[model samples]
Target: MAGDLGLWGIPVAIVGGAIRVSTPFLFVSLGEVLTERSGRINLGLEGTLVFGAMAGYGTAVLTGSAWAGVLVAALAGVVFGLVHGIICSLPKVNDIAVGIAMMLLGSGLAFYFGKPFIQPTAPDLPAIALGGWSDLPQVQAALNVNVLFLIGLALALVMAWMFRSTKVGLTLRVVGDSTDAARAMGLRPAVIRTLATAAGGAFAGVGGAYLSLYYPGSWNEAISSGQGLMAVALVIFARWNPVACFWAALLFGGAGALGPALQSVGVTKGYYLFYAAPYVLTLGVLIATSSTTRALSGAPGELSITK
Candidate 1:
C-alpha cells in the first residue's frame, strides 16, 4: 500500500491516522472538560495518563484481557484524580502547582513500576473493520477503526446532551459558575469537585488504555508524548464544549499524524518539523483565542485560568 499511492496517500493516511490518534485526545479532553466544569484544573493527568498506560499494559500482560486492563486503568485514574481533588480542595492550596507535582509523580511512578513490563506484550483492543467495501489496502487499513474511538465519539455526544438536559449537569455548571451560589443552594462544592475530578480521571485512564493496548500498542516511558497536558489547551479551545472538544481532538490528531503521513510517502526532509505540528497548532489556537481584556466566552465563571 505504501508503494501504491505516490502523493494521494498523504491525505488518506492522515485521515486514517487522525481516527487512530484522536482517541487519547478525545478521552483526555473530555475528562478535563468535566474537571474544569467543576471549577478545578488537574495537571496531574499527565501522570495519571502515564500511570494508566503502565497499569493497563501490565494488567493486560497478566490477565490476557485488554478490557480488564482498561478497567484497571480507569480505577487507577480515579485514585489519581481523587488525590488531586482532595489536596486542591484545601485552603491556600494551588491547583496548578499540585497538578505539576502530580504530573511528575505519575510519570515517576510509571517509570519505576513500569520497568518490568516494558518488554512484555499485552492484549490489544480490537478494531472495527469499517472499510470492507473498499478494495484498496490503504483504504482498508485506514478504515479499520478502533472501538474505543467510536465509544469516545458517542461519549462526547452523550456528555454534551447530559450537560444540557440533566440535573447532574446543571449542578456541575452551577458549582463551576459560583461556589457561593452552590453553597447557598445547599450544595457541597468541594465534594462535587472531587467527584468530578475523579470521574475525569477515569476517562483519562481509558485514554491511556487506548494508547498502550491499541494504537501504539505498547507500554513505554514516553508513550504519552505530552498529549495529556495538551488536552487542557484543547478543552480551552473547545470553549469547554464537549462536542467541540471532539472535533478539536480530531484536528489535533490530524496535525499529529501529518509528519508520519508525509514520511510514508518519502517526504522526510522536515519530518521532525511535521511532528511539531500539534504543538504549533496548540500555540496558534491559544493565541487566536486569548484576550487580555475579557475572560474567554463560555469558560466556567469560577475557573481559575479565567480569573
Candidate 2:
C-alpha cells in the first residue's frame, strides 16, 4: 500500500486521510473519557453526533458561517447531555439504559429536523497547509490540516495536564472513583456527574461539527458511520488518558484509510475489506485488552462496563 503513493505520495494520502478521519474520533473519544471519568457512561452520543452533524450543517447553510454552525451543534449536544445527566441522576435509573434511550431520541429528532438539509451546501471549516514547501501536490493536500485537528491535539495536552494538576479535575476524579466519598466530602455526586456528562456532550457535538464542516463535508442521514459509537471503544483503549486518546484516534484513523490508501496504490481487489479495518482493529483491541478478573487499572470505579 505504501508503494502506491509513489514515493512521497504514498504516505501523504494515508496521513491526510488519517488526520481527516481522526478529527471526529479525537473529539468524541475525549468527550467519552470525560463522561466516564465522572462515573457515567453515555451511549447516546451517537445520536448526539448525528444530530450535531445535521444541526451544524443546517446552521452553516442558513447562517453562512461554519463556526456559527459548530456553536449551535455544541449547544444541541449540551442539551442532550443535560437530559442524560438529569435523567440518570434519578434514583434506580440505569445510566446505560438512559444512554440508549437518549441515543434513539437524538437520532430521531435529528432525522426529523434534518430532512431539508440533505442537499444543501454548507460552509466548511478552514484548513491550514503545513506542507507548503513540498513540491508534491499530494503531500500538500495530505498536510493541509484542519484547524479542529490542531485544537484536538491542544485539547489532549490540556486535558492530560488538567487531570493531573487542576482542582476541578481532582474533584471529578473523586466523584468518579467513589460517590460515597464525594458525599462524605460534601460534594454533590449527581451534580458533578451531570456537569461532566454535559461537557462530554459538548465535545462530541464539536466532533459532529467537524464531520459536517470538514472531511466528508456535507449534510446527510448517513454521515456518522458509527464514529460516535466507536469513540467508546477508543476511550477504553486509551486507558482514560487524554494524550493516549489522541494517539489512539490517529491509529484508528489510519486503519480507516487503509482501503483508500490501497486503492490509490493500484490495489483494486477487495477494496471493501479495507473499510472494515477500523472496526476490526477495535475488536482486536477489545479482545487483546479484555479481562475477567478485574477492571482496567485506571478505570473510574462507578463506570458500569468495568463492574
Candidate 3:
C-alpha cells in the first residue's frame, strides 16, 4: 500500500476487498431475508452479529478450533432467536420492540463477556487460490477466496430454488402471508415463525463467524461496522430474493472498500469520503428503489414493516 502499486492495483484492491468484506453482509442480509420473509423482522441481528463475533472468537481461543467457534456462535444466535420468537409470539407483543430489546441485551452480554477475548489470536479460515495462474501478485491476493464465502454463494442459489420448489418454503410463505389462514389449515404460525427466526439467527451467526474468523481475523467490539443494520435495507433493495441479496451484498462490499482501494494506489485525498461511501451508496439505493405507491414487488403481504 506504500506509494503506488500502480493504477492496476486499485481494481485489484477493490475486488479483493469486496470479496473479503462482503462475506458478512451476504450472510447477514440473507439471514434478514429469511426472517423478513417469515413476516417477522429481527433488527437485533446487529447484536446477534456482535455476539457471534465475541462468542466465536472466545470459543476459538478456548477450543483451538475455528469450526467449533462457528458452531458456538450459531448456537448463541439460536438462543437469542428463541427468546425473541417466544416473546413476540405472545398476545399484543410487538415484534419490532422485542427486536430492539434483544439487540440491547445481546450486545450488552457480548460487551461484558467479550472483554477477555479482545486481544486473543484465533485460527483463520482457509481460502481458495483462484488466481494462482496469474503472474501478478495483486491478482493472486485479490482472488483468494474464503470457503465461507463460497458456502454463502451456494446457499443463496439453493435458497432461491427452495423458495420456488420446496414444501417448507411454501409453508413459510403461507404463514407469512396470513396467520389466520395458517391457523385455519391447522398450522401453528408461532411455531413456524419461531423456527424461521432460529434458522435466520443461525445464518447471522455464520456471518459473525466470517467477521471474526476470516477477513478481519480478530475479536473486537467494533468488528461489525453496522453491516448487520445495513443488511435490513439490503434485503429490501434485493426485493427479498436470496439470489439478488448476494449481488447487492457485493455492491455494498465494493462500496465499503472504496476508501482502502483508493488509498492502496497512493490516493489519500478525501479519504474520509471513501469511508462514508457505503452509507451514501445505501442512501442512493433506497432513493432509486423507493416507491410510496405500493409494497415492494417481492415483499411479503403480511410483513408489518411499512404498515
Q: Kindly list the per-residue Cα lDDT of model 2 for residues 230-263, writing each as its tens digit.
A: 8998998999999999999999999998788877
Task: Identify the leading candidate in terms of TM-score.
Answer: 1
Error of 1 at 78 (Å): 0.3
Instruction: Name the regions of candidate 3 deviating beyond 4 angstroms.
Output: 1-5
Considering summed lDDT, which 10 consecutive residues are worst modelled in model 2? 1-10
Alpha-carbon lDDT, every model: 0.93, 0.91, 0.87
Give TM-scores for every candidate, taking all chains together and pairing residue i with residue i.
0.98, 0.97, 0.96
lDDT of 2: 0.91
- Shift of residue 28 alpha carbon in model 3, Å: 0.7
lDDT of 1 by residue, 242-274 (tens): 999999999999999998888887875977688
Ranked candidates, highest lDDT first: 1, 2, 3
Q: Write the per-residue lDDT of candidate 3 for residues 161-190, one digit (tens) a residue.
A: 888899888888888888898889889989
Better of 1 and 2 by TM-score: 1
Error of 1 at 61 (Å): 0.2
Candidate no. 2 TM-score: 0.97
Instruction: Between candidates 2 and 3, name the one with more favorable TM-score.
Output: 2
